[model samples]
Target chain A: MSIVKRVEANDSWYMPAIFKGLGITFKNMVLNLVGKREMITLNYPEEKYEYSPRFKGSHILTVKKDGSIRCTACMLCATYCPAECITIKAAESEDPTVEKFPISYEIDTLRCVYCGFCEEACPVDAVRMGPEWQMPGINGANFVYDIKQLARRPQLKGGIVSVVDEEERHKAGI
Target chain B: MVSLKQSLKSFLQKLDNKSRSIYFLTQGCCSIEVDNLCSSNYDLQRLGYTIDIDDPREATVLIVSGWINPAFAEKIKEVYSQISGDKAVIAVGACSISKSPYVDENGLKLTDVLPVDIYVPGCPPRPEAIIEAIRLLEKTKENRETSKIIYGAIRELG
Candidate 1:
């Protein structure tokens, strides 16, 4: 346990170790300059890196055929949210065919874990995790997206509708 | 005194020379992901945008990211105050835009404290979106300078 290596003159000067480090750096610099080394660095802004097919990002509430929010105010998404960030204030739907509708639906992006549980819990495929990854804001209040904001999201094709929990899918013929 | 056109030309030149030196004020978890913008994949440095963590005074842009509760609000205000008037503020996350679930009635947003130039809304907006927001800001900035020059010239001629 009390073993100690004897220090040499070369170790004190450290010229050889410094040269070795410099040699590796110069080699890399030359290799990179000549395009011999593989370039892993992506030119961002000009270049875009693709995410996985099943990537989950921001939330978007789907619209029906009439362009109205498809949400039936089932409360399944709110119930399933582990973060409890989704708030849906349900009201009686004007249409007699529908039971209830979310008068005010908001998702706190800060608290959202981006877990697809809410999507999976949805029966009507009303809510979706959009492919939009960017969500920068200047104020905190803007993060709490309202019903209009969610409903207004552009329909990104091949987006996640719902996974796992689709009990009512067979009945609805979706 | 310099002529109106000469002053206007110099003003435009000065505005163009101002590099977007950003100072990131990260508060919560979401900022961790936003840090990926500096990595190899979405290298923001290549675009001449630098994050000066040591000094806010030199920064031309302030990127406010993550959740800002009452406590974080005070620190943000201090940082914002340190930055000069000739600067743009970009809010990067939903939490910075509004009070997240963690905050109550006393929670204060970055907007209430400082003027925001751009708002990129997402839970954690992608690096691409952030870049787009900045690009939009740059375009607007140039347009604003051009309009100012024209207005100044018109006033001088009148």
Candidate 2:
């Protein structure tokens, strides 16, 4: 039932095909030597490359202007997460202004799909995907970012904001 | 008598020069994407690691990537046992290190089954990050040896 292509005498020899490949290689080598062609290979690690603006890298828990964790512990992110990587344990906050705050919030970086759905699901604008794409770790614990790590992340350049202005307006009862 | 520094230097040099063979044991979906590391773009061969070794016995490092279902536990144990001599295990992806949506409580945890030396975490970790983890593992190995030699030298002096 298998179809087989006929091999010609020249094709069976294989020498001509090899020479053709070699010819292309030599041409490129000569071109490269004379600076006729530019090198495509980048010296990475030493020279960092830029990713697209829309690139969803890692998850960050946004904060209020008063330096308080903004998450209401609604579990919207956990519910929306297709991977079910986000876990939030809600507790009544000591602050009279806020109703609930996450006592323990963890996102297993290994399980996260980086879909930005969590950011979309957050009603309070508490979760946002940051620009910190390099999230590699040597151990399991490193990948599982706790509430402390998530809250302290430096605000990314332009991807998503923590709704700081909106929070301020809410506090002013506007 | 060989000095501690001399022994440390020799050990580091030996580790640096030798090429290592890596055998991948895939258990889940996203981990399959790790094959991209061998593509021309990533070029993991340049790092002196030969991936997907034909013989498990020939491999110096064992990479377990993806989910570990309860049914796959016996297979993991078999492959781990088959690899002869001193070998390091790297658990890649979240499912391997922790329980993902794919596995329940009954599913076997990777750390319980085998002594994992390194972990590369991500839904499917980027190839660059995976490469970085390998380098870090090598560095950690060198550090451990260096410390042991230093302690031995100190004891000899005493």
Candidate 3:
């Protein structure tokens, strides 16, 4: 009775609060055991994971039929990023329809958060994150991944348009 | 830590006692220097000098790869200041030395202030050339440091 009075005097909620604390650690402990290997890594390159149709991984500056970057240099991705980690320079293309091709487009992978905002910000569907997420470099500068590196090497599957003609028909819209 | 210079010199000694510790900075223009540093064929890190982020107190050499954006210019200055004495900054690529027409084409106006110790000229300089530059940086022991312009033959991207 004295304990109850003391509890009321303090105006503290105890049972649920104490149980909630135990439940939090219990959930994390269970997850720790279940996700030990997963915590260490993703089995990339060998076994790539599928992202949502809306998921963003790594940005690839895509090429048209004539083998040119499709980016018009609109600066949409650069403008939208919360981190301001992307850099691109636009140039007029021989094909007027493709007004600007990125004369210089590079991303500091060291600083990029891998948010799909760049992918969504792109109006021309030229830049999207296909599944190549593993950029292992000892130097932070090496982490500055370029457009050519991103585009020439598409490590995952099924995007706007496949660089390989054989897979072109299987592109997202087509 | 002995003097900052001495600590870095010791670090380079660990790579190959004969080699000098280099402060490699590869961000905007010099980013490819990182690629050349890591490519399986080039693998400059295997040669034994570590390349870190903007931190240069641990290093005595700086390699500017790309054009520094306005935002990063101050960071570069801060990095340059943190580096210990008797340091060297290697300006790499056309962008680092002279603003490449290609660089400005994209809306990036970068001014690489002069007095660079070594100028490595190329759109994207080859890894072999970078190795050669490392060798040069290691060999120059003059007390009166001077900016040296180095050029190589045109090469393939690979």
Among all candidates shown, the one with the greatest TM-score: 2
Expressed as tens digits, the lDDT of each residue in A29-121 for candidate 2 is: 999899987665444456555777776777777766666677889998899888788888999878786778888999877667677889888
List candidate 1 segments past 4 Å from native. Answer: A1-7, A34-37, A60-70, A78-117, A135-174, B1-15, B69-71, B143-158
TM-score order, best first, reads 2, 1, 3
lDDT of 1 by residue, B1-158 (tens): 45876776666555655547778887676576668777776777788777645888877678888766777778888888888646778877667766553335556677787888888765666678788877767756644544466445545654
Reference-based lDDT, residue A104, model 1: 95
Better of 1 and 2 by TM-score: 2
lDDT digits (tens) for residues A74-166 of candidate 3:
998999876567898777778643446677888865345566778778766777775443332211135566765777764533224534341
Clashing pairs in 3: A89-B106, B23-B61, B28-B66, B29-B65, B29-B66, B29-B67, B30-B65, B30-B66
For model 3 the local lDDT of residue A88 reads 82
Which candidate model has the greater DockQ, 1 or 3?
1
Writing each residue's lDDT as its tens digit, candidate 2 over B38-57 gives 76666677667887578787
What TM value does model 3 have? 0.35
lDDT digits (tens) for residues B1-158 of candidate 3? 34765655545434333224566656653575556565554555566666544457767777777765556666667777888755666766545544442323432322344246555544455454466566666655332233121111101111
TM-score of each: 0.70, 0.76, 0.35
Per-prediction TM-score, chain B alone? 0.75, 0.75, 0.64
Task: Sort the candidates on DockQ, descending order.
Answer: 2, 1, 3
| Model 1 lDDT per residue over A1-174, tens place | 898889978778887899999999999999999998678877765666788868788778876655667788989999888768899899997777667888899987756767788989987778877766745443333767887677775455423343323345546665
